[model samples]
Target: MTTKATTDDTAVRTSVRVDAAPEHAFEVFTAGMDRWWTRAHHVQKGELKEIGVEPRAGGRLWEENDAGDVCTWGRVLTWDPPRTFAFSWLIGPNWQIPAEDAAGSRVTVTFTPTDTGTLVELVHDGFEVHGPGWEGVRGGVGSDGGWPAGLRQFAAAL
Candidate 1:
């Protein structure tokens, strides 16, 4: 994996290679998210049931718990199959959902065809939109347990 984040960069960037074609890789990331997402990163209490993207711009990025409660991670901002996807990240720095009026971060992921497989790149930015504790929010997402860990799990799943 390659991390492009620097102390001065506003975004957390990382990428990995997945042993699959762009189309297959994109499907696994969108429709098959639950298969690779870390259960330890569950957004709510109790068991995680599923995590998924709704497959279109303005659609939902959500997770459902075993108790049948569903949490919206955010709304999908861009959704071009076999290429790229972007979404809002609504969960706050405190690990809790904020009010409806609160601002959220943005995450963009792209898949490119490669000689051996697909090169998946992810960039998480817009932390300043969160206001007061924006730095903490940035740090948390830039951590190893954030995008890095998720990408590793994702690549290994394929």
Candidate 2:
């Protein structure tokens, strides 16, 4: 996995590999984000109803709950088929404030085809503004209780 903080210094990036084709891996990752993502660890808890990715640049990355409330988690910044996808990552009060009229941090996921399978590189930038508090959020999402387990689930679904 590859990880780095933004130039401003408040976010983190993490990448990992999956045993699947690039296109398939990308589909599994985005279409099945909710399935593998740990429900218990979600910021909204049991209230999280659905996680949706619109599959295009400027598409919405959002969640809804049983209460009929919809919250935008992010927006697609770049969408290159079978190779790369970039979006905003905003959750919780801390990450909600826009850095420059833009909501949350930027997360880019790149898929590279390898002889064995696809290598998924996730880049989550923008966090230095939040300072120490961002660490907890980053750490939480990195642990087994977060994205790792979620990505594993995504891979298993394929």
Best by lDDT: 1
How well does each candidate superpose onto the true structure, as a TM-score? 0.91, 0.77
Q: Please write out the lDDT profile of model 1 over residues 1-158, one tens digit for every residue.
A: 34343333588888888779999989888888899998877777888888888889999888888999987878899999989999998877777745666577899999999998889999889988887778887888788887788888888777
lDDT tens digits by residue: candidate 2, 1-158: 22222222344445566667898888877877777665554444346677789988989887776777766667899999788988877653353423334445567788899887887777666643345577665665555545555555666676
Candidate 1's C-alpha runs over 4 A off are 1-8
lDDT for position 158 in model 1: 75
Task: Superpose all Cα atoms of candidate 1 onto the true structure and report the RMSD in Å to 1 decimal.
Answer: 1.9
Question: Model 2, 55: alpha-carbon shift in Å?
Answer: 1.2
Give, for candidate 1, the lowest lDDT window spanning 10 residues.
1-10
Segments in model 2 whose C-alpha atoms lie over 4 Å from true places: 1-13, 92-102, 129-132
lDDT of each: 0.83, 0.66
Error of 1 at 86 (Å): 0.5
